[model samples]
Target: MKTSTELALSLNPAKPRCTQPRRWLAAIAVLSVSWPVLVWADCVDTRKATAAEVEFHGRAMAALVAALPPVPVGGKLQNKDSVTTLGQQCRGVTGDFNLEATRFYELNFRKAIVSVAINVRQLRTDAAGLSESYGVASPNRSAALRVNNVVWTVSGSDSPLRQALVDAMDRTRLQGWVDKPLPSVAESEALASQAVPAAVAVPATGAPASNASTVQTAPQPAVAPEPLREAVDAVNKLRGLFGR
Candidate 1:
């Protein structure tokens, strides 16, 4: 007697035998398309920030706070009037913005000059409330504050991120801040003139002492490094969850 497979094939020879391979190909195609999404999802995993990143954030936050108009003596920072005023001031500097549930503003500070996402949230509720608000207090708290978005690519003075960074650098008055505006042509020429040293007259071997022209070398000024890119797309992705 023939084996079951052989008997079935003999009975229905017209049936396609390539179905298994076709199914496998379809599965592989799907997996190829889905692989990137899976990788991006994994980007949400909590990761430690580098020292430079932490320091940069501290400075950036200070710059932002400094840019805000001072709160009136009795006014709270989170109050409606204060929020509105702060939002206006921030927008004047940074362009359109999203005020996040009266807590912090959601800003897309990603540009060629700076890259950051200001969506990290803090746990302000009790443990029981936190658990109810977000399941599993430990992981939820970390997840709420994780940075996961890819940095956006933007440039020019029209960019809110670039403008915000420039304003920040201006406020700090630090020399060689990466986000500082490039000097205008006239300004650069003036600086070049100032940098160049005066040439002195020198004596030649057989001639009187005052006759020869001497060359003077001028050193080039150090250029600031370009702003660095970092993970900054996470805020746009999780706006709903974080708006609270």
Candidate 2:
């Protein structure tokens, strides 16, 4: 038995052939308009951040990695040409940015984001101390804040689902308290000053939606794991930009 679609096509054979191209064109148009909206969807279930966002941050991370003069882990930097080497590395890493980006964000994206925050904190501390000790101008570069904004922007703004995903994936089970939102240096330090409070699950009982859990927290630890050695090196190089 011929289907209704097939029967209709037999009656107007050219109709299907002509409409095929039109249908494809319409789909392409719709996707172009809706693409950004989908990017704002939950990164956990949707995992649909805009490709531009991913590519941008991936390149930035890679470039930043390259800019620093390499100091051996806990060893002093021996080369003055570290920034030059890093610049070349940045180009190399960013050459096939899509693949580099996949490796960047697949497992270690959050850790990279956190590392930026930590470095920002450390830089602020260093700047403050330098200003005080040398009576120099404030060197607040605002790198941390910029990095936070970009991370959240590309990754997706915080929503309940996003936080829950953080909970589900975190090995530390810190998903409850962390909310996994990037913090300003003040927020970071304030969190570190107090003992952590417990995370509370909102009762889904007789509720319209199933989303549960409210995080309550006292403070974040003053320190994150030592900043990525490469990132820290990049931060220091910014000193030359400022003629420090």
Candidate maximizing lDDT: 1
Estimate, for each residue in 1-244, the C-alpha lDDT of model 2 and write its tens digit: 9999999988987733578889999999999999966865433232333444444334444433332212212222222321111111121122211111111121212211111111121223242211111111222322222232111101223333223223322222121212233333344344335323223233365846444455557897675456676687888899879988
Q: Estimate each model's TM-score.
A: 0.20, 0.18
Which regions of candidate 2 are displaced past 4 Å?
1-45, 72-244
* Residue pairs that clash (backbone atoms under 3 angstroms), model 1: 149-234
Candidate 1 stretches with Cα past 4 Å from truth are 1-45, 73-178, 181-244
| Cα lDDT, model 2, residue 92 | 13
Question: For model 2, how big is the CA root-mean-square deviation?
Answer: 32.7
